[model samples]
Target: MAFSQIKVLPTTPLEKLGRVGTNDVYIQKEGSQYTFFYKNIENKEDESIRNFSFKNVENDFENFYKIIIDGFNANPIYDIKLELPNDYVWLHYTKTTSKLGVQFMTTNKVTQSTGISQIMSVEDVKKLFEKI
Candidate 1:
């Protein structure tokens, strides 16, 4: 699961966008198909991050694009300060729009109590993926 060894599966249409620690990011779409996957290299027990697909492809893609891309485009970064020890990764599935949204907070693996945050532009995020 080394970042350098990450590769998109054949016929899957996913494009590697880079890695955050040991988690590899990807985006995929072909015609009406749209999807995303996060491969957790650190978790040898279950390498797949899971939960990207929820049966409704169209709506899921729309929401993912809206919240992760468009929402960030509109509002920029939203930060929260919490004093917690556990790390969390959350995906919000909106019932009204039938779309997906993601939120995550990372705790220093060694420190376990301190959180790490970063700010990046939408364009920068898109640039992580190799040109097709």
Candidate 2:
């Protein structure tokens, strides 16, 4: 018998954490590295997953998240990327003489798509983070 190579799609086994809107959050471990994963389901037939790496899951991640949450104190800028790994998210703030709104830009490298959330109030952003 001769040996033949088989092509397989790369997959990282994940543990489900929770879901955020159309995105499902998960955690994966690769040796000593811990990765955060998100799967965005556009429909029953289409979905994509993205990965973000974190050094210290316990302290570093918590501190970083706190810093992000605290940033709501100031007015939002036009484009500010969050400290999250792999450029996963961007904060978009719009302020006009007549209106002020907050929005987020999230990217999925695997799918090569960037999604913009609907304009929301500052409080809505805070509540969304708390769910994660």
Candidate 3:
């Protein structure tokens, strides 16, 4: 994508969060590099959970989500994206009796959903991630 094609979407309001009435995530584009932000569900010093870093997001999705879940045992919806077209997006992983499922969503319409990942060996995601 061209650098000029990237733009930041307006912020959305989320009441499920605390303290701040609403925090905004931005989307920006600069050529092929795209970036976005997901609210840090964990406060600093909350070692129980970890923040998304260059390592996890840059790694496999399954491993990333598992590391995230294992961090706090809390399945959090991540605000993530690359650098380039700035926009807000979320990756949500749900734990079930039989398996764990991954989903992609946006704050604008919580009711809408898309299944981007399914229960599978974390290594499988690691493979596809490499091709990306």
Candidate 4:
């Protein structure tokens, strides 16, 4: 489902942190709960933008966070960082047009869902894909 359907979800405000230069949002809460979201911008000359309605995937909060953020960090309220078991999966998707034909791309990255939501260096992430 979507974040909207999360049980006991928090209403998070979207902060304008300049031009999305590589930082993410960290949700701190009581108990053992954590939420994260990240996103990156892309430029394409020929590609259709798809909008999936929140009503359709309201149960995939984890997926929603990954779709928006390049990376995330979640932790317990204690003094240490906790690791999310293998149960949590993060996936990202992108569509592009190329000389061959239309390309549909997707990647699922495994991440520890604990510790600190470190603000990534946008430049570093960009260099990873050589977007810069």
Model 4 RMSD to the real structure? Answer: 16.0
lDDT of each: 0.39, 0.54, 0.34, 0.29
The residue-by-residue lDDT of candidate 4 on 4-102, one tens digit each, is: 655885765543322223333222222323323333123334222221112114444344333333332322111221123333322222223511111
- What local lDDT score does residue 128 receive in model 4, on the 0 to 100 scale? 26
The TM-score of predicted model 4 comes to 0.19
Who is ahead in lDDT, 1 or 4? 1
Alpha carbon lDDT of residue 101, candidate 2? 57
TM-score of each: 0.33, 0.43, 0.28, 0.19
Q: For residues 13-129, write the lDDT of model 3, one tens digit per residue.
A: 422211111222222333323332334333333312111222223544345435534433343534343221222234555557845543333332333322222222234333323
Cα lDDT of model 2 by residue, 1-132, tens digit: 654786677975654443344445434455435555555443334555645566665677556446545555565344557655554676566766755555555775566565554454555444444542
What residue runs in model 3 are displaced by over 4 Å at the alpha carbon?
Answer: 1-85, 107-121
Worst 10 residues of 4 by lDDT: 98-107
Q: Using TM-score as the measure, what is the rank order of every candidate, best first?
A: 2, 1, 3, 4
Q: After superposition, how far is residue 26 of candidate 4 from its true place, in Å?
A: 2.9
lDDT, candidate 3, equals: 0.34
Residue 12 error, candidate 2, Å:
15
Positional deviation of residue 102's Cα in model 4 after best superposition, in angstroms = 29
Best by lDDT: 2
Off by over 4 Å in 4: 1-23, 40-119, 122-132
Native-referenced Cα lDDT, model 2:
0.54
